[model samples]
Target: MNMKLFIFIVLISPLLASLSSFILKNKRFAEYISLLASSLDIIGAFIILYFVLNFKPIFLFNNAIAIDKFSAYLILLVSIVYFLSSIYSISYMRLAINNEKMTENEFFRYELFFNLFAFTMLIAPMINNMAVYLIDIELTTITSSFLVISEVTEKSIEAAWKYILVVSSGISLALLGTILFYLSGNIPGSANIVSSLDWTVLGLNAVYLNEGIVRIAFVLIVIGLGTKVGLAPMHTWVPDAYSEAPSPVSAMLSASLENVALYGIIRYFGIAGKSLGFGYPEVILITIGIFSIFIGVMGIIYQNSSKRLFAYSSIEHMGIITLGFGLGGIFGTFGALLQMLGHTLTKSTMYFGAGNFLHKFKTKNIKKIKGVFHIMPKTAFLFSIGSVALIGVPPSVIFISEFLIILQSLKDGYYLVAVILIGFLLAAFISLLTKSGSMVFGKADENFKAERGDFSPFSYVPMLLPLAASLILGFYIPNGLHNLLIGIVHIINFKIK
Candidate 1:
């Protein structure tokens, strides 16, 4: 079969299975179906990765459907995050099942939408048409809003409503921007007249594009996509949503969906920078990135809820990634991509660790829990390691990536910005270490007890796989993987060395 066809099937199968899960009479069967569908998608991702490694970029069903190193790499990422989340959900959802607060139907609803959310996150990267890309972003927002309030709690509902409003507004602007891009290309006698918004066309003809109109389009697209990336000011919905949602969904939001939004920004920025010079977009990205760093680290340092703290950390890391991108050179862009990969693995691991802690303690409050090492030593130990990784401590992938970013920052003569970046990161490390490390390693509080929990394959695999990947990547990135990433950088027109 054609690689793109196989990938397309892989992408669509989950949505079909999710729909079946919603209507199927046997809920147990639906669970199995969900698992099977995700596993198949995972298999397909591995297969596609193999092809991406050995073959040229695959285009299928016309040029509108294509898979390149850029898209293939992201597909692999979503597969890793979503597959693990799915496994984790099996164990996590069992908790909801036992609780009298949720209905049988409600659990199924949650599973259905969760699958849909994962599917859309995967599909967003492969979309070749701007309209299709906008549509995928809209689907992500809609599906995730329901997932946010799966528990139907008052706070979750508020978060969901806020999410719906903010993301909907953002997507609306993005759609308008997409339309404007088409108009910018359609101006009188200036360029090719294919009703096509193909990236190749846009990039090739970018110099001929109307500068003012293109700038307007880029601004709209960035703000629209920026809301999803949890850039500050537009980030109000993230903490509440992540804190209130089930931890796995929070992981997906922070690790997977946010990355998709960043990809969207990069796609547009590529055109702008190649045509209009990197200065304009770099300034905007830098401003937003710095602000997000300040907000994320400060918020995490003082936060009371463990999950909320992770949410803020996600924002901070995203800022770092954006900062790397804004630097706009080969090394800078490479660092940006590396930072993205590292953050995804680290953030998801952090959330999974947080999920384990939440399951044991049944609380989100940071102060109320302590002596987790005694209660659940394996989980506590893992959580502590994950937190260290999040802080970009040495020998973690994040540390290496952030080191590259900082080096690039200094090399680029952004001295003050580098100082601020270091300051925020140090503050964040101190805050999380003080807040989480003590809770895990210190003596038990009066209410603390090792709440014994069942160990399922589903729960352990998700947490461990990504963490192991982080550890391995941190200490030694495999030569093959390094080459693959270098190829991706070339494909995207970024240079690292």
Candidate 2:
């Protein structure tokens, strides 16, 4: 099939599914439709990736939409999460409707927005225009905020509100920065030289951009998009939204959406680095990266809610990714990209496990949830292993990514940075394992006697697939994936030959 046709199908499938689902509202079949659509999306994304690797980048709509190796990889990541979330939703939404008194209307709305949310994220990376990309990111924020309120409680409502308000403000700042990017190229005699906000155009003409203005604009872009990416000081909305949204939605948000938002920051990082040299962008990313890691670890240390704990972990992981990109060598950049894949797989597994706990025990409080080894042995086992993997234990993809990042710091002679990075990694490892250990093995309450089994196969199976993939990849990255990562590293112009 023509790659453009595949791209069209990939972009339209979710919208068609969303509309059909709302019209049908057949509780019995709605989930299957969603699953089918998401599956198609995954196939399309993979095809695009395959084409990009074997051929050249695909462009359509007068260069308005471009799918290169980087974008293809992101599309695949988003689709993977969307596919898993849809499968898990079959089990999760059913339980929510029956046990939590969720209205059929709310359930229908959830299905509608769920697919729309995925659609927005799917398209964000495909847009060649940076401005349109930000607009698409804003659309994701809007659609997902509705998903946050799918349960319709006061706290969920509050989370949705905060999410919209904060993310919108951040996007506005990013718009200002984008306009500055246009103006940086539109100086008195240069008006006709640069005519589009497409990343390709700006990147090609980066040398013509006013360096002074590009510097300030790049900073604004980071701060603005960083809010959407859940970077620190701009991350207040993430915990609330993640904790309140349904588990499937939380998986999408943390596992896929943040990476989509960070995709914007990275594109700009490439542009700004090309224009103003790597020093400025690298320092900015490294500083924010380290600070965000600190905040996330601190949050993990004190978190009481299971969902919020993982939400904070998302922030920590994002911080690590940001730092990796900032470190800017072969190891650092490759490690960051690898971390993105590892995080998508591992974090989704953990959140799905958390969903099982919530469904089984009917609580999110860490102290109130206990004896998972006795209550739901499969979930407990998978969740426990997932937690270990998440904290960068050996033979997990995360361990490889984190190790590569640390190696980069040492190679660059940043001893203090290396120490701090290791310290934070150790802190996260100890804190996460300690809390998970208490929950998984803590004494079962005398009155708490639920069945000693997992939720439907949907729940634990989704968890198992990602965990297994992470472990296998840790031992050996397949040649195709290795080359894909190398292609991306080249795209980002990191020098580490």
Candidate with maximal TM-score:
2
Off by over 4 Å in 2: 190-192, 494-497
Task: lDDT for model 2, please.
Answer: 0.93
lDDT of 1 by residue, 1-497 (tens): 47756786787889887888888846677777777888888788878877877877777667776677778778877877887787778778786667436677778888789889989988888778877888888899999999998888789999999998988898898888878888887788865543568776686777777778889998898888889899886899889888888888999999989888888888888788766887898888888899999999889978999899999998898899888888767666777787888888878877877887777777888887778887777777777888888788987888888888888889989999889999998899899899988778888777555445434666666777788889889889887667777776665553334
State how far residue 399 of model 2 sits from its true place (Å).
0.7
In order, the Cα lDDT scores of the candidates are 0.82, 0.93
* Root-mean-square deviation per candidate: 1.9, 1.1
lDDT of 2 at 141: 93
In Å, residue 109's CA in model 1 sits off its true spot by: 0.4
TM-score of each: 0.95, 0.99
